[model samples]
Target: MPFIDEPAGTTPMTDTAAHGAASPWWQDRTPQEIAALAAADGVALLPLAAIEQHGEHLPLSTDLDIALGLVDAALPRVRAGVPVCVLPPLAVGLSLEHSAFAGTLSLRPETALAVMVELGERVAAAGFRRLVLFNSHGGNKALVDLAALKLRVECRMLVVRANYFRFAPPPDALPADELRHGLHGGALETAMMLHLAPAKVRSGRVGNFDSLGRHLAAAGRLLGPEGEAGFAWMAQDLNPCGATGDARLATPALGDRLVQHFARQLARLVEEAHAFDLARLDGGALDRAD
Candidate 1:
C-alpha cells in the first residue's frame, strides 16, 4: 500500500539495530520506524559499484569497496535523526569492455536497470520517498540514469544517480599528462584504490602494461590498447590487461586526498539533492531524437 501523506512536520527517525533490535536498515524495519523517518527526514542512499577487473594490482571488488567507504564517510554529515541507510552496493555492472580480462563480471545493461528499479519501488513503498543512487563505477552511469527515469515514471520516486568524481577533484589535480582520458584502471581510479584500500593497490605493476601511453601522449586520448587510433566500443577497443591509463603515479597519499575531497563533495550534493523537487521535471520537453 502507498504510504499515507504525512503532516507537514512531526516525522520521526527510524531505530537502528544498535537499540536492542535486529531489523536491518535496508532489508527490514518496523512500520513505525519507517513512518517516523518519513515524517522527520526521508532520504535513502544506494551505493552502486562494479565487480569488474581493475588490473592485477587491484581486487575485483575495488569499486564496491570504495563505494561502501564513501557511505561510511558520509553518515556523520547526514541529518542527525534521518534514516540514512546504505543499501548494499550493486557489485556487478556493464563491463563488456573489460571482458577480455579475467574475473570481470559483466551484467547486461537491462539487468542492472531492472535491479535498481525493483529496489527503488521497495524503498518508496517503505516511505523512503527520496532516493539517491550513489554510483562508483563509470560503466553504470548510463544505466543508472535510465533507471532513474523509469522509477520516476512508475513509482513517482525521486531518484538521483550521482557520480562521486562528478563532484570532486583529484588530489594535486593530476597534471594534464595524467588527465588524458582512457577506459579502465587509469590514474584517477588507481589513486582512488590506493587511498581507499592501500593494501589492494598494485602501483609496482604499472609497467609492462599499456603501450598506448605514447599514443595518449601524442593523440591526447587513448586510441585503445593496441594503439588502434580509432573510435570503438569497450569490447573492441580495450586490451586484456584490464588497464587503460598509467597507474605508476598512483600513491596512497593521493588516493586519501581524492577520497576525502570526493566525500566532501558528495555529502554536499546529497544535502542539496535531498530537498530537490522532482515534480518539476520537464519530461514533455524531451525529444526522442538527439
Candidate 2:
C-alpha cells in the first residue's frame, strides 16, 4: 500500500469528503449507515491515546494527535474488500508515570481495562465482529493487552491490540546506541510532531537527554537481561523533564517518512484482519501428547 502525503495542515477531520462515501471514520456516518456496513463484515478501529506530558517541547495532546494522525493516514489505503471504520478515539489512557507532570491526565490500569472492554462489548453488540484497539501510548500497553483478551473471551468477537510506534521503521540517520534508548519524547516523536502538527511543537526548546543507563537498569529490573528480576519505576526517576532522547536531531522530513512507513504497515495489518477466519478455530479438538 502506498501513502499519499498531503500538505501540512490537511487533517483527517477536515478532509473527510476526499475519501467519498467509503470514508473510514464512524463519526461521519449515521447509525443506519454503520449497520449496513457492519452487515458486510466491517471492522472498527478504536484509537487509544494518553493526555500526558511530553517534555518541554511537545504538547500534552501529543499521543492523541499522533494516534489520530496515523489512523487517518492509513484509512485511505485500507483494502477495498475490508471496510475498516475508525471510531472516536479514547484519548485518556494509563499514564501514572506522568501523573506528577502538570496537564497530564491518567487512568488507573483497571479503569482503562474496564473502559476498553466495555467499548469492545458495545461494538460487538452493535453487530461488528472485529475491533482493533490501536494504542499510541506506552503506558496503555498492559491495559490494552489485558482488555483484548477479555473482550475476545467475553464478547466472543475478534479483538486486536496494536501499538502504533511498533510499526514505525527505525531511524537510519541515528546511531544504534541512540535507537536503543529513544522511546519517549525524543527525536522520533518530535519529528513526527513536526510533520503532523508543527504549530504544537516548541522547536526552540527541543533538547536531548541521555537516559541509556536508567532505561537499561529499568529494563533489567522489570524484564530482566536473562529474565530473572523485576521492579517498578516512574518517568521522573529516569529524567526530571520526562524525555529520553536527542530531540535536536528531529526534522520534518524524517517525520514525514516515518509517518508514511507506519501508515503502510498499519494498512497491511487492517487488510489481514479482514481475511482472518475465526470459524476455523471454533470446533477444533485438542490432541493429547503421547
Candidate 3:
C-alpha cells in the first residue's frame, strides 16, 4: 500500500481519537495549524516499515503494524513539548533478502533511498528542524541511514533512525532458550503482536527454531540470516518463511511487557536525542588563546 499523507484536523494532543478526541496529530491539520505547532516545536516523528512476509502466523505488514502502535504509544509523551506527528508509514522497503519467501514483497533499495530523501526535503521545507525515522523493519536500515546522512548534510536538520529493538534492548525476561533464538517472528515479535493485535495472530500457528546457526550459514549467502555475517555487498538470501526466531514460546503477557518496555525506552531516547547538541565540539586547537 502507498504511504498516507498527514491529514488536516490532527495535531498533537494527549487524548487520542480512539480515546474520544476529535483528531490526533497528523490527522487533518491546516497549514497554519501545522506551522504554528512547528514554530512552537521543531521535531517530527516518521514511522518506517515494510509490507513483507512475517511467517504464517503474523500479518504481511507486521512491521508497519508495530511501527504504528509505537507511534500511538508515544503520542502523549512527545506532544507535551514537541510538535510531534507521525507520517504515514512507508510500507515497501528493501526486502530482497526475503525474496525466497512466497508472500514476501521486496523493493529496490534505491527506491527507498529516493523516497526518503524526497520526504525529508519536503518535511524540512514544511518547517520541521529535526526528523526521527522511527524504523520497525530490519531491511530498511541501510536505506534509512543513507537518507539520514543526506538530510543531515542538505537540510542541516538532525535526522535519526531509531530501531525499536536496538533502541530498547530486551530485558532478561523471556527464557534463555527462547531469547537465544529470538530475532524475527520469535518470542519477542509474536508477543508484541499478541498484545497489539490479538485478533490478527493465528493462535493455532506455532513453531520452534530449527538449528539457527546452520540455517543462518546457508541463508547468509543471501541475507546472512540476521547477524550471521557482517554486511558486505549484494543482498543476502533469506528463508521463505520470512521468520527466524521461535514463535512457540510467545505469550500475550510477555508481549505486553516487551511493548511497554520498548515504548518507554523509545520515549527516553527521543527526549535525549531531542535535547542533544549536535554542533558541540571539543577543542581542535584551530583557535589561538583568546
Best by lDDT: 2
> Would you list the C-alpha lDDT of every candidate in the order shown?
0.69, 0.79, 0.70
C-alpha lDDT of candidate 3 relative to the true structure: 0.70
Better structure of 2 and 3 per lDDT: 2
* Model 1: lowest-lDDT 10 consecutive positions: 12-21
- Name the regions of candidate 2 deviating beyond 4 angstroms: 1-22, 168-173, 212-230, 283-290
Which candidate would rank higher by lDDT, 1 or 2?
2
Model 3 regions lying over 4 Å from their true place: 1-24, 175-180, 214-228, 231-240, 281-290
What tens digits encode model 1's per-residue C-alpha lDDT throughout 1-290?
A: 13356555655332432456433256565566566666655688888888888777778998888888777677666654444656667788877766777788988878878888898888887777788899988778788899899888887777887987566475456755456444457777787777777777665676423535545557766454333464445632444565666677666777777777778776776776666654456464344432
Q: Number of clashes in every candidate structure? A: 3, 0, 13
By TM-score, the best candidate is 2
Better of 1 and 3 by TM-score: 3
How does each model score on TM-score?
A: 0.78, 0.85, 0.79
Clashing pairs in 2: none
Question: Which should have the higher lDDT, number 1 or number 3?
Answer: 3
Global Cα RMSD, each model: 6.2, 8.6, 7.2
Residue-by-residue lDDT tens digits, candidate 3, 134-216: 89987788888899999988988888789886763466777754554456677788888998998998878767644344455
